[model samples]
Target chain A: MDERSLPDANLPPFEGGRSLLLGGAAAGAAGLLLTLIGGFIAPKAALYSYLIAFDYWLGLSLGALALVMAHNVAGARWNVVIRRLGETIAAAVPLFIVLFVPLLLGARYVWIWIDPPQELAKETLRLLQYKKPYLNFNFFLARAVIYFVVWSALALLLRAWSVRQDESGEALLTRRQRKLSAPGLVLLILTATFASFDWLMSLQPAWFSTIFGLYVFTGGFVGSLALLCLIVTGLRSGDSALGKIISADHQHNLGKLLLAFVCFWAYMAFSQYMLIWAGNLPDEVTWIVARSRGVWRPVGILILLGHFLVPFFLLLSRDLKRSRQGLAAVAAWMLVIHYIDLYWIVMPASSLDGLGLHWTHLTAFIGVGGASVAAAVFLLRGVRPLPVRDPYLEDSLRYVQP
Target chain B: MKRYVLGEFGEPEDCVEALRKLHEAGVQGLDAYSPYPLHGSDEALELPRSKVPLVALTGGVFGALGGYVMQAWMNGVDFAINVGNRPPHGFWTNIPITFESGVLLSVLSIFFSAIFYFFALPRPYHPVFESEQFRTASLDAFWVSIETEEEEPVADLEEKLRSTGARRVHTVVESA
Candidate 1:
């Protein structure tokens, strides 16, 4: 509430800290341009990659929300410094609301299961029918509403508790938060897992991952922590209190969480893919076959190296964990790879045509992801950027693993 | 009321002031409390060691055995079904649930063992609750005590308590 790297309430709003605004604008322009370019020439591969881009962006937003919930549940005090950074991403939930318009508009092209009941393969149809109670257009729309409701509810509640603590230094609120966290964790897992089933898992219709929900969860957590480290560092440079408020120990701790998520994301992704490949069932392997080949294979290799190996090695040094610059470099790398990983997951589905560039996808990317932030920024305006009042803040501030 | 007041230490060459005093005075069976967990509280107090971890480990093993038995009994005998060529106990499939059950059991047993280990059954040694010294532990204070249940009367313990640098010595009486 008092000290910030950007603008504080007493000070005017941080005018130029809106790369997101420009980013959103750029995405809109790109999407519109691609929409026009692809209008006359509908290339299959390009269409597929464009669709995958949607998953990539949405994954970023959803993953951010999941991380916020996990931190709240685990009572991780050191993470309090980056709680708002996570919140900014969670607050972008509304952008997704706008983003989904294109997906909903283009559902048939994206989801084969959305095609008529008689036309789909028998197993696919059976699965589709079984899931119809949940996967039909009406239910899908309803579920989308529900998903956002749960997500936005968590974002609002956690952010509210944090900012409230800024005003009142009562330690009891921290205790109250611990009590609330267990249930919040449950709600987060339930919503995130099933929402995966609704959104991406339904793409193939037949494929399932008991841990697929966790895959999304892990990606979100890693991506947010990277975004978090970068944002917090940016905030800390000039903000005097922030410099003191966040310490080497906190950085080390957050870096460790980042490392853990990076590993978990690798583990879950590998295990899920391995299990499906090992089973070699047509239903399961169908999902992996595309990514394991050609242009997608290089991206796959890049993901293995960039997402897991690079971070794993770079973060190995103890000094890197504690240093701001070292950790920020790793984060920037993580965000870029995360985009690729998201791209890898969705592009394979639309392989019939070449991975053509669409102005709409780029437009939708900004329109969807951009508008999400603009809405969040407007709502988050005047809101306290730090949870100054958390009882655990002091505990977290002085915390060193004893 | 017998009270113990702990005071400043002697030189680095000297033994722990409180323990040296208590041993010299033959103060048998006193309880100690501190604001924070002191490094050598047990050794200074000369209390018998706790075997709670051993009890906890035994309880954990028992819990894991129970989880396995319960699953085997349920899947193998109770309501078994053959799925493909897989065995009824396909414990791999049951790994997640079994592990969860075992963990749940271990935690529960630890809770119960702690109650048994810390407090004896009949609860005969109840001390009167009112004491400023006890409250000081919540803030900034450290003290130790020997019970008044020996050949030595409560008066002897009280006298030794003051020389040990105790801020105050209070005799906690039995309930009337």
Candidate 2:
């Protein structure tokens, strides 16, 4: 249980991180350049693809922030080993603020109300007029700035305090973090909820689901957990001391959590659909109608199977949950399905009739994802992979599944 | 009549280690008792993995299928009530109940199977209970009990238990 017992190599600025940062940056540069070029060719599709990619990466960062805050607020010890990973991901929020510029510039293209087309239905035009107070471009930009500012402050403060604790080993720092996280979680969830309303829900301005925010949040959180699984398993494959401390028991717990959240995301998705289905109202049913048409129908079914059913059953086995390879594979699959889930959400608004598959989708994903990875690794540089000075670090390391 | 040799250890680890050693020694009919579940006790005792999950899965799948069929028959075929011009057997409406039934059956199977089959509850008596000091198995003590027939050698088993760090070793006979 002693900190001295662990190998000194657990301290960061390692060889793997350097290569990871460089690789991520190079991929980011290439992807962004490609996305830019693709934008000029098919401006509308490119904008939508860029939005999907942007939302996917931003959700991950915000979800990581939420997880770290939840861990601190709840005094969870099992995840203390992976706390820094969450912090590193959360630290990418500032980078996302810069990434938001492209989406902001093309907001009109992605959102219908920003500049409603002349052929928009009379009913929809009236609805947009009524929603004008909340859906205007300037207000939308302002809200985006506020969201990033709040997220940046929360993520940076938590990371700074945690890193300071590594050097000073201040127990007060832990209590201070718990206190900050208590209010921080509430604020974060509220802003995130409203942000989902602004970015995703507004895509279908005529339609609204009260649970859309929760649905988005749940999907993102599940994705973040999947990312954690991959990173933990990936690190174990290497010689990182951080990976050495994590036992299969920890992975099993994480797998259990991933399953739980997967179900939660499904539940939220179903709840939204069921309510709208039962009401059979024009405002609500139109959203579902748009999605169920053409190739989108198959995409919806794919989401159901890939996102929930597959992961649920796979993670149920004790053997799979305990094995690094099994859990990591499911995690990776979940990440792919998560992108599809986002694409399904954002792309439907772009092209209601078809899949609207674009080359920019892949490029924008690489652009955002690679840059996010680079930023996370950069923040992680020179920092201990785990909170070595944490009082509960030993408890986490020695945790046995009961 | 069958005789049982029971070893009581002060520590769970020692008890589990003794179980492992006894298993390695090729001793049969082994079980461990403690106030709380001990980690690695399953492996130490070399017990096969529990089949409750299998039972639960079977129960859940059947339950879900039955739930969907019940709804389909009642709404779509049997009663055939028309509501709101939607499909008579609404897939969306059927889902919640299907899920609930699956969970319900899974829980029922797990609970019943565990009590009636796995734990073999309601018998009320075990040979290990013949030793008055063995009562601590459910309190503060960790116990490993080995069941044997009347013809097997008991003295060597008692000796083995004492050598394996058992604080209070006792032999008990079933009264028929």
Candidate 3:
């Protein structure tokens, strides 16, 4: 076979083309407007919804950063073609610093421990008092800033090195990336774990699970992979140049990773549930009881079937992973279910009454998710879709699944 | 009425090219053997995607349902013995076992389906082994074999294989 006949192996650099920039601006504007409207209609619900949306999008960006760092550390070849997408998504960590402001502003409404009701039992008050040092507004805000700063600095450093590698093609940069990623991954995991504890897990104040961070991390990683697949598939269809560079082999590898994370997320969720159920601690069980009862039970079931099983079965096939349309469908499904997973975690904490969807939920999701995606796409538009000058470019282009 | 032509190539790519050309030339019953799987060789052969995944899916579904039902029957109906004061048939408690069973059966199904259905395991011997050069197929050399009716001339086939970079071509007759 003639290798030269194949499309140019390098992706042309994209510089935020006029139409894409306009589209991103439009989406971001629409999302912001919807969120503002939601806040006006239902302040508390909007705050809660914003927290959920913030957690979801932030998880995605952080997860993408972790994946890219891990890939660099491992010197993984399969993800090289898709690595730029991960980097671009990770670059939005800085945007998250700004995005988290609404959550901080509304913290008093969303966090029960921030300001306890006077009628609360003495025991509950004491418990909130005990957690105060870690959960205080100032401390929480400071930690949020630290997490974002650490994450954004690392994201920027890694991305800058990658872009430099694109121009310089220096093999030494790969080594530097690998070396940096070693500590970068550790920092990411530590910060992400504590951040998860501080942000989402503290919503109920009394409820604590050691595995909660892992659960949240897994969900984020899974969502990031799904987003990557969706974007790559969309690019394949929309951009002929990129379509030629990224082949089915890359998609198949991505689908496999997505499936792996799906299983991981399920494992983490089940582990948390089972350990809590077995321990039967009052504080621990309260969280599960809140979600496992009333209308929340069905929602839990949906997460099981929709989030795990449905995608599990659909992605099991080799053909589906290899087919662009099939992989995209599964990616889309996973993305939706990932939001549901986050909603399941965040919403129940706010509305203990039962499973209910407020109009604010939709608005906040659209607002936050749309804007996050827009920002990431805008970042992506500024660079080549693939690292064209990487020493591994040919290796990535010729990658064949074993 | 049975005859075979075997060609050996120094490279996997050459073997794949020969197989593809032969396939495109309307040659019947073509197969390639290599020390390692060659990229795109499967596509050139036009082989159907394996059904092992479907088999595994069916097994997983059955296993999950079976595990769930067994637990539900034994605890909820058969004995009604409750542990931990919780409902015996609660899906939450059963999930761990259900997941284990599903994974176990899916893996087992893939193993059995691939070995028995796809590779046709347990065979003691095959005519492919009759050619001594065929052993190299599992080593460094790549080989392409074609079966044809005895009445058809294989000289043209040998010439075609040579054109595709086959180093050596040989004709073998098999007893019916």
Candidate 4:
């Protein structure tokens, strides 16, 4: 078929539905109200739950940023149809910075080593003292600000160049994006790693995993891919322009990527466990011991089954990957599992009873997740869903699996 | 003896077009050989989806169960031994090796099934090789073959093949 005959090439810009944005905003506001009520009722639980939600959503946004940059750096053509959606997702980085304010205010309730309680044992206090330079509040805030600035600038620059390409159709902009993506990716990895370390890992100042940063990154990457799949698949319904341009072959490719990252996440999770088990050091072993015994044990097993084995087996079939409903089902399952995975990571540290689930977990998740989706949808308004003028758009539209 | 009509093309697109035309003309027993897999050519030929993946899945399940059972029988029934005071049938600890064996057997099944079942390998001779043009099917050409009863008109089929874009067409006969 000739490329020009395809009606997708002349697709108009997406004018996002007002109801979708308004619905998202309403849900977000309701969640925020619940979070506030939960905070007043139980400040400590609310703070910890908020942190979990914060880290989960942040992982998704940054993960999308990294993927977008990766697509640019590799000059990949298969993703051009959905590339603008990724940019829109990445544009939520600034909104996350604003959300972080509550976490900053509530830090004292979550971080044990922040003020070093007067009742702390001699050994723990000594351990915390040794970690003082890195764990101080001032340094933590500064690092966070730096991470946001770097991520926001990169996302905005790439998005600006993409929008410019729509009007000018300058092939040079492609070269410029390709050039910027290389360093942009390096900066992303560095900032994301330290940010994960400072934000989540430091919750247990005594325990550490050398691979923790990569482990967190893999979860985020997998979650982001799942989110992208869901968003694209959702838009592909309802007679949208995206529905015509995107094909089963694109879904198959995305499904393959989602499978690869699921395996990658499993590998990272296993490697961390095996290393910690082999070393048997008290600090590292404590993290695993807490989760592997009692109520937390079932949660650990759930992660193993739901997060890895089920998705791995389901995605293995070529037919399933190519089926829109099947792929969407898997993507939705992955998104839920990703939230649980983050819950497994964050909640165990603070829960006195192993595998505790407070009502605030749900409220905070909705509050933060709803607000993030609203911001992303708002960014999508008045923009072309597909990178309409990208030199590779035709290639992406015509892509067929060999 | 059975007579077969074969058409050869320099490119996959021409071969696919030829296959589509022949199928529309009510041709039966159509098959294609190409230097590389061609998109939609399988549909053009109306071939069923291959069973190689099913074979692989069965093999993987068997291998996984075999691996787990071997460990369980060894530790719990056959010759029980205690290692680090873990349970006799600790499946959690047994997962890595079980997974390894499953993947190994699945891959091996795909490899061999694709060769033996799909490709029908190990035969030293076939009538397709009687035509020299068929040799290029593995190099840079596409070939389509149709089997028909001895009474079918050969010239008409050849003309259809030529009109549909085959570079060349031939008829071959061999004893059943």
Candidate 5:
């Protein structure tokens, strides 16, 4: 079949990106400043928690972009409607380059392996020193840079390929994407696992769980879904290039993705908790002890409620599944709970001795969240909302979730 | 002789209008194919109900059963490698992988079923390929094809097409 590539007329006006850029910048600055200040006023632990939250939030943003690239390269039909949202989320990858500065600076504060010579048993020091070859500050920065570089390259290639398809009508672009997906998925998993270990789990180096990376995967995957749904809801209201073909099936499929990830996250969280609890190991249990305890207990319970319960129920209804507004609300809640979920997982590492609340928590959240999101929005506003030349643009237009 | 008319479509509405006219003109058994699925084209052509979903569903059910039987046989009876206290059949632990396989199988089943059911893949060299409009169907072209047995010859098809909204009607011999 001669695939005459179709022209795209349905994108947001080029001029509109200006305001989104400005809003993103303003909001990002505000969020980052608030997060920083909140961290500063809090106890030392609160600072670590904020830093952790910042790391995860930024990480998922990058992860989302990576997911988009993969789906594009894979040329999978199911994800066509939401893939643009993922791509836009990915466009925020540069923000993570900047966002990691806090994580890098806080390596000493968060990671036991950082100050190798300080307070460690002979055996522990030996381990830290042995890891020094790969664990040193310089190497960490280099790896971070490499991840960003690889990520940005993939994102650009995927987005470029998609846009070119719009005008070129090369069906082979889809084949190219399919060829790239396996490698892309492998890269995504490796980077995500290492990042989880480095940014979240490494803070308390003594603790280890083989599945730690999968936990992050669960959250990142679900978070991406929530973000995708929310973005699509917003796009449905706006003049994104995809305005023509969005439908109930698309939203329903998004809902199903959201549901699957939600369930996956629960399963992972349960497996992690149950295994440690059953084994009753000191090293592994310390993380859970703080998490499952008194002041922190409510937070854990809240994570269960908001992260699992609310979204599950909200997404359960087929009616809600098909409606953009309903899914959008659920997506927004999921996003907020995602932050809270990260907070519960990471904050308790610091907050275990007692309930640690400080203004720094809010300030840092605002500082980082405000700045990162604003920057993401700013960057997103700079580009056309949808890839106009995507070879699959027409396919995406006709894509129903079913 | 069996009749067919083809037209170029600059806009989606043109295609829709063409479809509605053809349908009303009694162009039964007519089909339209485009580079992408057209919005409102379904109603315009008044095409017969699609069995693709049911075919896909049947494929999924078969896939799920295959997954279950495959995993069960592997872990339960085929090579039941016992590990300490866990049961010989580690069915619980096997569930995730099993689920993934089920999903994977279902997808493959749907894809292949879609191909065979629609006869889209393996590229059939149907007689309809003779029409230039038929060639454009893979690109920007929209067309309505009705065999002589389904409707009267050319004029009847053209009048019906022109009335509802055919941009043009051209005869096509099935591309042998």
Candidate 6:
């Protein structure tokens, strides 16, 4: 709207990614091979660890997808500069469809309900039977397929339209994106909720909480926001194109949202615990009881401090959020805590006694994480770093927090 | 008696530019008024950071502590009701009320501090109201006003404001 030249939309695509892609692929292969060996030696433990790692990466990618859809629907201008990065992360959902196969092959090892133990009481068996209508393997597989299809469709369509706009520069593309995203957000939340239930909650078929989906979704969203901060700061330097576009104002805003979601995740976690603790039902209370009593208790406490309190206080500073290194440090810390959070959720059922620090956990995490990073970098190199032709790109570049 | 020299600008940008020039020239007691917030005005005015957040945090911390203690005293020690054989003081149950009171107190503190301390509002009249054209400060025009407690030469300041693009300038004297 002002008499200033806008950044050229015809800018060159991002370069210098082949080494990162190859390195990431190498790490991923090594981790996956080691995890494959763990499958033969300690099949159940390897499967559970792989599940934890799988959930961490999957949730983060979905979180990115959720944010991009929300940005489109709300027409937020502050995020327009870094919208491509989020789109790239979200666009990596198809990769998870391939990664989900290991879980499919080893479902019984991870989920007790898949092959209920013979030592179980008759009443417990009856309960499993009652849940079979919803939790059966066939329905579970169908639902997983539906969830991935829905997620990939939403993510890919949004990215395709956005990329097309780079050359077409049509206002219609923006309108079309908003149109799909408005409904896409609802579809995403529903699918994500069901996905959380199927993959994580089914680990303990007897336990149920209405708020579990929201809890998982919030944590994943927080992780993705942290990842977004790291990606922007990692890619940008004083002389880079992103550095010219993204200012400290943008980082400050991202930090504030990260802080807010950290609180929300805490709230969701606590709210679920409080209600279950109050209800004191035999079925529901057992889940919380198992988590609070054993080695998992200390892990929960760590999440309280590391995931919530420490970052909550650290990110409160106006200066740290604006600084590149400071914000990136906090982001990396949160990503680690997010993995631990998932580990705490999924590992309790598998390892009854201790924190269950296993080599496979590390290997499986590296495998999934390395592959995800490689996919993201590969996707990033294919497009312009930012949505250069977005109608609101200038607003984001000039954005100053009020 | 103090004099308030008011200048009107057709554009908020010109008004902000004039404010910066006046500030650089060491002219004190300068402020701007507009129907909407003008970007860069805070920098031009060199305003100090607001302390409302600190006040809010203090209130919230105290409120949360008070809430927790009130529950602990009333339920755990004072009456010590036995409900369903649960613990007399349930820490988990106390959290929701703790969070609510914290938020409630934070909002109350921010509202009161902003109204009475930061803004000093509820006054009905000011010397700026004497100029009918100044009413546009709230509707359309941008205004820069300088308030001096002691008499200062008015003509040079008026010339500076006009030179910087103030379309109309006038001085109002407050009767004391």
lDDT string, candidate 6, A293-373, tens digits: 868898889999999999998998888898899999999999999998998888887854487777999999999988988
Comparison by TM-score, 2 against 4, better one? 2
lDDT of 1 by residue, A5-42 (tens): 32222222234436756665666556645653563375
**Candidate 4 structure quality by residue, lDDT tens digits, B96-144:** 7787888889999999987887778887877777887778889988888
Off by more than 4 A, model 2: A1-15
Which lDDT tens digits does candidate 5 get at residues A1-402?
A: 324344354565234555656665676677666655544554356457667567656666766865665565655665665565576566566666777776676566666677854656787787677667877788877877777777766666766676566557687876776667668777877887787777778666667888988887778778878887787777776755554446566777878889878987888887887677656776678888868878888888898888886777677567787787899999888888887788776766653456555556665665666656665555455355565555555676555432
Q: In model 3, which residue pairs have backbone atoms overlapping below 3 Å?
A: none
Deviation of model 2 at A400, angstroms: 1.6
Candidate 3, residues A1-402, lDDT tens digits: the string is 335244565666876556755676676678768887778777788888788888888888998999999999888886777788899889888887888877777778888888899897899899989888887888888888888889999999988889888878899988888999999999998899999898888888888999999999889999999988887788777756776678888888889999999999889999999888876889789999988888889989999999888898788788898888888999988888888888888888886455557777777777777777778777777678778877777788778887
Q: lDDT by residue for model 1 over B1-176, one digit each (tens)?
A: 43333222222111235765686566666555555555445665566656664565566667777778888889889989887655777654554455567667777767776666566545654463455446665466555656654434766666666666555667665444
lDDT of 4 at A351: 58
Model 2 lDDT vs. the true structure? 0.88
Against the true structure, what is each candidate's TM-score? 0.63, 0.95, 0.91, 0.91, 0.66, 0.96
lDDT of 4 by residue, A1-402 (tens): 112345556567777667878888888788878988998899888888898888888889888998889999999998998888888888888998889998888888888878878787789899999999989999999998999999999988888899888888899998998898999999998898898888888888888887888899889999999998887677666578787778888878889999999999998999898777755677789889977888878889999999999999999999988887888899999999998888888877885565667788888888888899889888888777777899998888778888
Model 2 lDDT at residue B163? 94
Share of reference contacts found in each model: 0.00, 0.50, 0.20, 0.20, 0.00, 0.30
Candidate 3 total steric clashes: 0
Give per-residue CA lDDT, model 2, range A295-401, as digits (tens). Answer: 88999999999999978999889999888888899999999999999888888788634688888989999998899999999988878877878878877876789
- Which residue window of length 10 is worst by lDDT in model 6 chain B? B148-157
Model 6 sits at a Cα RMSD from the real structure of 1.8
Best by TM-score: 6
Q: What does DockQ give for each predicted structure?
A: 0.03, 0.42, 0.31, 0.29, 0.05, 0.43
> Which ranges of candidate 5 are over 4 A from the true structure?
A1-13, A34-46, A116-134, A164-178, A238-245, A351-353, B1-176
For candidate 5, the per-residue lDDT at B133 reads: 55
Give the worst 10-residue stretch by lDDT in candidate 1 chain A.
A1-10
The backbone clash count of each candidate, in order, is 38, 0, 0, 0, 49, 0
